[model samples]
Target: MVTDPRPGQILALVGWSGSGKTTLLERVIPLLTARGLIVSTLKHAHHAVDPDQPGKDSYRHRIAGATETMLATRERFVLFREHRSADEPDLALLLSRMAPADLYLAEGFKSAPVAKLEIHRPSLGKPPLWPDWPGIIAVVTDAALPACPLPTLDLADPGAVAGFIATRLGLR
Candidate 1:
């Protein structure tokens, strides 16, 4: 697989469904922003997604076979690119299309070749992904983890988690 690098480095958050990736991001994003760093996020959804409402013109247009649609407004606009094929764009392609920032936090694309932080919740009865996934830099968990060499951070402490992220990504 070929890899392309973007101006903003990518860090992926990986874990089981209930592992609190979103919760941690909600807390840590603010801390990262307060430190004067621009943060952008990419969410890889497993299911089919449509942001447009059912009765919206944009939705109707796409349903009628428009390959792409743009919803424009005074304050902001969104471009919807309809993919006719089954395969979704890879992480590199998505990142390239995004506006540059100090760092990019990716919530999925678990198998992608990028630095990753595994959010492990022992209570969730899920095995640690760090053992299976390549490029996992550290493990973030609330419970005590045994016999792991990677640095572990407290799940409740967003400050420490954010610090670890900045330090690893060189944004600090």
Candidate 2:
């Protein structure tokens, strides 16, 4: 496969479904962009999803055994593909497709190479995934623990986290 020429940063926002990963990303994007940063996001879907309506041309193409389908407009383009029996596309593939951007934030792929920040709430009663994984760079969580080995920040403070990322990744 051809490689991407973009200089991209990868950070993953991972946590339980309700952990507010998307909400945080929604806020982070604007803050980053305001600072003149170009950002793109990649979300890993765990289920069979169809971005196009059933019986639509794109949908039919997928249902008819096409390995991949592309939908494009003057302003944007979307590629929908069926994995069939293939292994999920790895992080490299996603990164390669990223537009030339300052950063590429990923919402899932917990085991991917990208550095990650896990979202957590004490009431969720689930332990942080960091213990089982080593790629996490920091954590943005509301739950206060005795002491974490990694830096912890407020979940609501996207700017602070964005700054931290900028510093850590030398984006600043």
Kindly list the per-residue Cα lDDT of model 1 for residues 66-104, writing each as its tens digit. Answer: 988999999988888888998888888888777878888
The 10-residue segment of model 2 with minimum total lDDT is 1-10
**TM-score top scorer:** 1
Clashing pairs in 2: none
lDDT of 2 at 165: 78
Measured over all alpha carbons after superposition, the RMSD of each candidate to the real structure, in angstroms, is 1.7, 2.6
Q: How high is each candidate's TM-score?
A: 0.93, 0.90
Clashing pairs in 1: none
Write the residue-wise lDDT of candidate 2 on 1-172 in tens digits.
Answer: 2134543377788888888889999988888888888888889889966669997888888889998899889999888767787588887886766567788888988888667888877778777887887678788888776677889989878989888878887785
- Mark the regions of model 2 whose C-alpha exceeds 4 Å error after superposition: 1-8
